[model samples]
Target: MPADENTAAEATEARRGRGGRGERGGAAARRAARSGGGPGQQLTYVTRKLPVYEVLGEEGIALIEANADTVLEEVGIEFRGDAEALALWKEAGAEVKGERIHFPKGLCRSLLSTAPSIFTQHARNPERSVQIGGDATVFAPVYGPPFVRDLDGNRRYATVEDFRNFVKLAYMAPNIHHSGGTVCEPVDVPVNKRHLDMVYAHMRFSDKPFMGSVTAPERAEDTVAMAKILFGEDFVDQNTVIISLINANSPMVFDETMLGAAKVYARHNQATIITPFILAGAMSPVTVAGTLTQVLAEVLAGAAFTQLVRPGAPVVFGTFASSISMQSGAPTFGTPEPSLVSYGAAQLARRLGLPFRTGGSLTASKVSDAQAAYESANTLNSTMLAGTNFVLHAAGWLEGGLVSSYEKFMMDVDQLGMQQRIAEGVDLSENGQAMDAIREVGPGSHYLGCAHTQANFQTAFYRSAIADNNSYEQWSSEGEKAAHQRAGQLARQWLDTYQAPALDEAIDEALKDFVARKKDSMPDAFS
Candidate 1:
């Protein structure tokens, strides 16, 4: 298509995407972007707006753009680990030596323009829907290192079993919509085998849209092979991978691993989900606006690279921004930064007419205490309200998503259910919210068994577990437990009653054989 035709198509689609549930982010964003709007209106939980960055006004956007440019120039990524990757990087105009491959700022920036902004991944249970490059919830549990201590006070790592259980939980989790499936324990499997194991678990547990981590460039083909094995020879060709994640080091730089993976995934028509995080007041300019501009720049440069690799290869804009705690000097997420950044990034994604991804139930909280509830509530509220289509770290997160908790998993789901209710967004249709029932009661009479209420009670109110649904005496009799306690109990019940999915006898045998073969063939990695 000519440049003019492409622009025309974008313009037309942008207009058409404005009013549906999928475009909730688009609607709330416009409302919040209005100048001089009241603080309440701009608050992410109340309406769709960028998470509240300390930087207000145009400066925030400026910071995002500037940082992106910095990344392109001084911090270009290079692949130095594997021969195939090195060859590809060099062919792609990346400069390299030893274990690092680099690229030109201009080339990096150019790729952002042509990347495909939308793609799809069909789920086995058609009821489970995920639109990778659209406006809808596509949540995945947190990935990366684990740092939380268990009841024994021993620090737990992300082992293969841990990865499998997490994937299993993700399968059972009602709100956790995506899987960073290869979530690994640093030592459980060697880098190469880990991807295969992760993919194997995913193919067995679910036929959902998932992704491969670009933690290392050398492992890219292994991840791709997993896709091939699961979906057959045309996996990449069928666009079954949907989207692949590419993480850009914040402050400034695209590491070799992430960049090369982006190229490989894009070659297959998979969307590249690239997120550049700025530890505000740390890796980023302290000012909120300045940080945003930098963050945006980081993402845009990568988006451009994705476009260059294969114009219109599916890509979803990702924003992972957090602030530094002045007292601790450590980065803090699950705070206002995650939401604020999500909001701003969604705005930018809208500006570009692409799907947006953001964090959820985010926090820097440790235990599942009040702090956990507070942080989780705030982040999830912001993401759903902002209409983020791809919500990451949505459940099974504890200790800022570094640890998985069966307990916290259910808690997050409960919280998400509440948010979904809110997003169901005031059913004020003439007969929707049951306004007629309220009017019939007319300011004082009890509507306990009113005809209208009898007909529509279920639709009229927000229900809850520890949400105070009883008289003082009734409550006293049950022992007033806090919301978290109720949530905790619910988690236990699910685990106790949960039936592990039964695999086909032949399929199960195949899986066992595969693991056994991997263990035998690569003792160091699998054993």
Candidate 2:
């Protein structure tokens, strides 16, 4: 029997049982039989519990909330070209003028009440699953880059092969928690049909949780359908397996295409990140406070819309705030203003009891040079401090999001290791204190040979694979390769050694057939 048929039979059995015990037992059995169950799988990297750095006090938070509400009621937001969304808003007691939606004060917040404070996002490999929201920060790779930087330092339009390789890199990297969506745009693939290939690549190349398609409503449907085939319809319905990005057309607009994709994910109870893509002084206000207010208002409207679609639907309060350099009309990243805005936005999300998403290893540097290193580190530190739950572009970001550099990807992944260790903080357990080692070593003796040091030496400290920690003489003896050189070597090494996770042969065949049929049914359409 098909999985859905078995599910229906189990439901019938539960209904006929005397108590609810049989029903609970049936549910337990179904969960145990969930796909992706296996042993000895690597666990996804997660942040240990730590205090989130808050830049905003009570007054600042209140002022931002008040300004956001003002923007909602007085300024209003546009849900352009989405009639159903406009109608839904109207029925929900909002004043709709064409595509613009004006909500009464407190309505958006009230609607957001049903959204879960934290939710579990399952992966194909059960051990790779992650808890998104709260203090737990989930790091994902760079998203939506259209160009790729090769090891030989050549930049070109990304292809389907480049896409698959990035997926493999994400799979092999222990730091990245989610496989992510649109690692890069494959210019060689048709716009309409590319989503199918992207989803297939993620399904076959990585076992980590990943985002779903949001390019069009049909593509979003395809994502759900494909997920159903892999995880079973019942499992997909019961658990949040996909976390799709639903970006808001900033300056108070939500495009029809994005809204349509969001509706599908919301209805299915899959997670969606409601991000306000703001470039301060360009897409939003010039001031950080002003930009933060707009971000809050846009996210509030989007999050509320998700709840209206399906109450208790998992939604992330997201912000993609950057600044436009006054000297040039270019967008800048890892600047002080965006960091401040991100800090406040996180507080706002916390105030509304929603998960926050923002910050990454963002940089406008063209190469993996010193500028790239500093900028990337600045953003990563901000995200870690602000307690961002889902960090898109956590690694591999380059040239103001226009390219994904392989060398930078490896270097950033290594830095993410440092962040993880810092988040773990100081362990004060009896063993961690190392009182025995101190006593054994006494005043001036070395503790390297002590029992405690010998026992815990392997895991004692973070060892950097990218950074050279050798003495000057030792460094001179060996070729003094730069960080990027070492990182490039590591990137190529990972690609050379990566092995795709094992999947059931029947399911793999089904996935391939589904892709072939879907591609055949649609003519290539480029937007």
Give residue 289's error in model 1 in angstroms. Answer: 2.3
Cα lDDT tens digits, model 2, 1-527, are 23553454345322222111111234433322221111112335566667888998999999999999999999899998888899889999999988889999999999999999998887776557788887788989999999999889999999999899888888877677889989989999999899999999998888788999999998999999998877878777877889999999998999999999999999998999999998899899899889989999999999999998999999999999999988898998878999999999999999999988999999999999999988988888999999889999999999999998899988887787778778888899999888988888999889889899888765577666678888988877877888899889988887886767777667778889999999999899877
Per-residue lDDT of model 1, residues 1-527, tens digit only: 23543343344333222111121245443432221111112112112223322223466455555565565455654333346555655667767665454456556545555654554554322233355554455667766645533323355776676676667656555545565544435455676567666766766665445776565544565556555544434435644454667877775566666777887777776667778766788777776556666666667656766665677787777877777789989767667655776677776776566777777776666666777777777887777766677777777566655776655665675566556545545556777766777888987689898888777554355444334567988877877765556655655454454344333345445555665665567556434
The whole-model lDDT of each prediction reads: 0.59, 0.85
What's the lDDT for candidate 1?
A: 0.59
Model 1 clashes, total count:
40
Cα-based lDDT at residue 414, candidate 1: 54
Off by over 4 Å in 1: 1-110, 145-155, 182-192, 433-444, 465-482, 500-516, 525-527
- Report how far residue 257 has shifted in candidate 2, in Å: 1.0
**Candidate with the greatest TM-score versus the true structure:** 2
Name the weakest run of 10 consecutive residues (lDDT summed) in model 2: 15-24
